[model samples]
Target: MTTVSILPISDANGERIYRAIAPDKQSTGRTAGEALDALTAQLEGDEFNALLLI
Candidate 1:
């Protein structure tokens, strides 16, 4: 199974943000959902379908 980690973080400006980390891809967004969405878009094939969120 493919594993991904989603966590909240602060940007350089101290703005709340969300980050998604996968084996081959990473993405950040203003919200957790957005971060996951962005990461999902970057993934190829059915990888997203078997994603295991951590």
Candidate 2:
């Protein structure tokens, strides 16, 4: 199942998707956007993939 991990965004319906989090990790942020940015930068490769669910 595609569980959409909710997170903030400058444009939620834009390029970036959810703030990918580890299955056994805790996040440190005040807002979703902040968390998203953190995840975006901390993740493995670039932030471009099949993130949409149709």
Candidate 3:
């Protein structure tokens, strides 16, 4: 199964940033939801085995 980790962060402008971490892969978004969407899309188009948000 593929495992991913989510991390919340802020940019220089203080905008909400969401980061997704996976083996040899990473994705970012302006919001938590967006980040998850992006990360999932990158991982396997919503067919991921599992997702872990932190």
Q: Give a tens-digit lDDT track for model 3, residues 3-52.
A: 77888888789877889887767889877677767877777555587657
TM-score against truth, every candidate: 0.85, 0.39, 0.69
User: TM-score: which candidate is best?
Assistant: 1
Model 3 TM-score is: 0.69
In the predicted model 1, the residue pairs found to clash are none
Ranked by lDDT, top first: 1, 3, 2
- Encode model 1's per-residue lDDT on 1-54: one tens digit a residue: 568888889999999999999988999999888998899899888787655564
Q: By the TM-score metric, which is better: model 2 or model 3?
A: 3
Model 2, which residues run further than 4 Å from truth? Answer: 1-4, 7-26, 47-54
- Over the stretch 22-41, how does candidate 2's per-residue lDDT look in tens digits? 44332334456565456545
Ranking by TM-score: 1, 3, 2
For every candidate, C-alpha RMSD to the true structure in Å: 1.5, 9.1, 2.3
Instruction: Output the number of the lDDT-best candidate.
Output: 1
The true-versus-predicted C-alpha distance at residue 50 of model 1, in Å, is: 3.7
